[model samples]
Target: MAFQSKQSMTEPRDRTGAVQGIEGVLLANRDRIVRFLEVRGAGDGAEDLFQDLWMRLTDRRSGPIADPLPYIMRAANNLMLDRYRSARQRELRDKAWGEASATHAPSSETSLISREQLALVETAIAATGERPARIFRCFRVDGLSQRDIASKMGVSLSTVEADLRKVYAALAVIRRQFDAS
Candidate 1:
């Protein structure tokens, strides 16, 4: 809890005689912080989140924090929560965007995909196999959540996720072929 001298105040928390910027403390604990983030559900984004944390700390006036490491870590956790909320909202918006305008007819303006593109997409989806195609339809066309689709299809959640991945891989191949021509 002791304050370091102004000269080295920007250094890592462990150095007793001096204090440094929050950035220094964060840099010193980079591995630990990123590991914490990974364990906290950041997955592959932990490193990116660490960089973002640095940027967030950049403009703030350097002040003597009694526990700089934990303070910054708490900030990272908040960032993750904010990210999760933003992604959830975006998914909700996308789902709502796919809903019927009226009479179950797709809105042309909303879904501007050409008939040719739709045919390509449908063919690619069907090529994945019956289960994957069904899963794709249940999730995308039926607008059911993966969990709901799994329950309805009598499959495990992981099975649903696996089928969706297969379907997406086929769709990716279609996209590449389409882009080439």
Candidate 2:
């Protein structure tokens, strides 16, 4: 989106021009900001931080900036750093709390349960032996299309289709188990 200058640079009113100039950068850099956060630290909260940055930028209480682009970028960077520190502090505090409140059951018991369920699934797939299992995993779990899987596995498209049938059967059994549960 184009950043329309609401007023001249010399205007005495709110620095609407300055803020509007930065709006384009903000819009274009959203994905870049998210990727930066996802890679550097705030993988889970990148979107939240992005929203917060916009809120801070748009807040009327901040008044007009002399040069809004650099100011907003600096603000975003500072916010990300603050988020990283806060997350680390929270993690440390949670760890200490867990140690103090230790019980017979660990906090990761649910994760263990899920892992066990996944292992059961693997075992079930193992009953189909290696090739079909690999094909099923490549096409399903890895999200490859049948044609792509066939090309990668050096197999015919028909073979890929056949393997998909086995995958469907296995998944139907798994779905039935889930439904029964």
TM-score of each: 0.43, 0.38
RMSD of each: 15.0, 14.5
lDDT of each: 0.75, 0.68
Worst 10 residues of 2 by lDDT: 104-113
Task: Write candidate 2's Cα lDDT for 1-181 as tens digits.
Answer: 0122333334436556546646667787778767765665667977887888888776644334555555666777778876665665566457657778654233433231246667877887777768788988887789888888898989999988887788678866975784354
lDDT per residue as tens, model 1, 91-167: 54565567743443433343334578989899889888999999999998988999999999999999999999999
- Following a full C-alpha superposition, what root-mean-square deviation does model 1 have from the true structure? 15.0
Top-TM-score candidate index? 1
